[model samples]
Target: MGTVLLAAGVLLWSAAHLFKRLQPAKRAELGDTGRLYATVAIFASILLMVLGYRWADPVWLWPRAGWMIHLNNLLVFVAFYMFAVSGLKTSLARRIRHPQLTGFKAWAVAHLLVAGSVQGVILFGGLLAWAVVSVIVINRANRDWTRPPEAAIWREGVALVAAVFLMLVVGIIHGWVGPWPFGGGA
Candidate 1:
């Protein structure tokens, strides 16, 4: 049941996100209510995903390796930095058309690297697939993109700092909520 809920949540999330892009006319026809519906669906999907993930039984695929953890840490750092780059609209935004989704893919892959359970694979792999499909769809739909202007150099530093701060906060929260990341038993 938990795995089913998780799968449903992932599917719902993808559907809601892609609806606007895939059916712009239908979305527009619905007017403002479309946005409301989408928001509600997204929230519900998130709730389902959280509950399902926490309650799901594990089916391990592989043994955990020390190197995998280290790699996950590095990739996670890069993922967070990429997210910050997108949010900050730093110079990187000018070059990377979809930094946010790219970062999301990175984050998913980082989790997949350390994930041995069936639930973890489904969650991360489904999200990763969604991100990949979204990128392809978006690129095909809009071939021409107006890149953002070159941002100030200081903005890059701020983004880096933001990434570090976010990583620290997330690490602490993750440790408290789940397994302690550093040398702690899961």
Candidate 2:
């Protein structure tokens, strides 16, 4: 049941995110109401995934090494920084067309490396594929893009602060619900 819910959540997440790109005409027809529906779907998807992961039994396949945890931590931090780059228009923002999606990919890969269970692979790997597909769809829809101007040095500092804050908040939540993330653990 938990695995089923997890799969459902991943499907819902992918479908909801791709609806705009996949069915632009239909999305346009829905107008403002689509935003509301999308918000609900995304929230529900997240909820289902969380609950399913918590309830599901782990079938560990490839066990994570101790050093992988450190690497995961570093990649996770980079992912957060890249996420910030999307909004802050930092250095990499100009080079990367989809900073947010790239960050999502980094996050998924980091989790997959540390995750030993089949369900973990399904969850993170599914998300990774979704992000890749989203990029491809977006590229297909619009081939042209304008590179934004470089942000001021001050914005980099601001972006770093935001990333740190987000990491701290997520770290606290992870510690509360699961294992501690700061120490030598995954």
Best by lDDT, which number? Answer: 1
* Candidate 2 error regions (>4 Å): none
User: What residue runs in model 1 are displaced by over 4 Å at the alpha carbon?
Assistant: 183-186
Please give, for residues 114-147, the per-residue lDDT of candidate 2 as tens digits: 8879889879999999999999999999999988
Per-model TM-score, in order, reads: 0.95, 0.95
* lDDT score for candidate 2 against the true structure: 0.89
lDDT of candidates 1 onward, in order: 0.90, 0.89
Question: Model 1, range 1-186, lDDT digits (tens) per residue?
Answer: 999999999999999999999999999999999999999999998998888898899989987898888788778888889999998899998999999998899989988988878988889999999999999999999999999999999989998999888888998898998876554565
Among residues 3 or more apart in sequence or in different chains, the pairs in candidate 2 whose N, CA or C atoms overlap within 3 Å are none
Worst 10 residues of 2 by lDDT: 177-186
